[model samples]
Target: MHTNTSTLAASAVDRLRQEIFDGQLPPGTRLAEAAEAKRLGVSRVPVREAFAALERDGLLEFTETGRTVVKQLTPQDFEELFAMRLLLEPAAARSAFPLSRKQQQLLSDNISATRKANSLNEVTRLDLDFHQLIVEASGNTRLLKLWRSLRTELELWLGYLHQQHRDRELDTRVDTAGSHEGILDCFQNRSAAACEKLTREHILSWREWLPMAELET
Candidate 1:
């Protein structure tokens, strides 16, 4: 029963998270407990718990009126988060090499999953997993925890991007894969400097690609 309740909580949280990410529950939209509880087919307890969890992650805001609403990503927030990713992911890439065959396979699997992803949401999830796998493979628990902390906000940003651009191009996929491939090569060659450079470049490239106006609004 304990395990089932835990699973329900997770499910409720994920459902709410995805709704926010997909713009179905847009930023600043109030989360009404009774309404959401009915919509999600769960008791108010799990919904309230999920709201608290999301608020802690900066994905939701609690109003003085006791309403919870999705939070918008400010431009500063994006800059800070990406800066941190630039700092950490490259180091992770440098440490990623000498990977067991299993690690290499995992990377390959994520890449494959990205290719097979049919929707923008699916692709976003796979991409997140791909980078997260790299971070996790770094054998640094602290870095992994930091990355997890950023996941909710990152998902919101990525979701906005996907919504703004309905169809993802093949070129975009290839470009992203190339960046990951470069990092993988650096790992394979045991060249930390090169990996770091690639990671920094990848993070910085988002500046050119992201919709600045949308983020600010």
Candidate 2:
């Protein structure tokens, strides 16, 4: 019974998460446990558990009035999120230098799969997976924990960026694959400094597409 309840809760989580990513449940949309439970054909138990899980994933938040709503990310939120990415990812990549042959192959496979991705959502997942594999390879458990904690927020931000690119008819697949290839080359050559620089630059290159107005320093 416990295992079955857990599975139902996990399923509820995935369904709701995808809905949020697909914009079916846009930001600021309120969610109710009983309603979602009915919609998903599960008991209120799983729905309640899923809500708490989504809250931890940063997709849902409780208002001061105690209503559960989808998270509303602002321009400042994007800016702050990217700032954290810049601080951590490049350093993680540097620490992951001299990646093993198996790790290298995994990255190469990820890029190949990304190139063939049919949807922006798939591209976003592959993109994050590429970076995450590097972080995992770093062998720093604490760093990996921190990175995982940011995973869902990063997905939300990157998904929004990809959608914007799609609306503008900008195909970022080629650019993304090329950038990964360049980073892989650095790893192949065992150039930790170059890898760090390239990784940092790769992240900064995405700043142009930010929805935020540039603030004066």
Error of 2 at 155 (Å): 0.4
Q: TM-score each candidate.
A: 0.87, 0.92
What are the per-residue Cα lDDT tens digits for candidate 1 across 28-47?
78888889889989888878
* TM match of model 2 to true structure: 0.92
For model 2, state the Cα shift of residue 95 in Å: 1.3
- Evaluate model 1: give its TM-score: 0.87
- Evaluate residue 108 in candidate 2 and report its C-alpha lDDT on the 0 to 100 scale: 98
Q: Which model scores highest in TM-score?
A: 2
lDDT of 1 at 101: 75
Poorest 10 consecutive residues of model 1 by lDDT? Answer: 208-217
Compared with the true structure, the alpha-carbon lDDT of candidate 1 equals: 0.76
RMSD value for candidate 2:
2.8
1-217 per-residue lDDT for model 2 (tens digits): 9999999999999999998887688778999988999999999998899999999999999889988999887778778877877988899888999899999999999999988988888888888899999999888888888888888988887776665457632367777888999899899985888888998998898787674323311
Candidate 2 residue-wise lDDT at 116: 91
Error of 2 at 199 (Å): 0.6
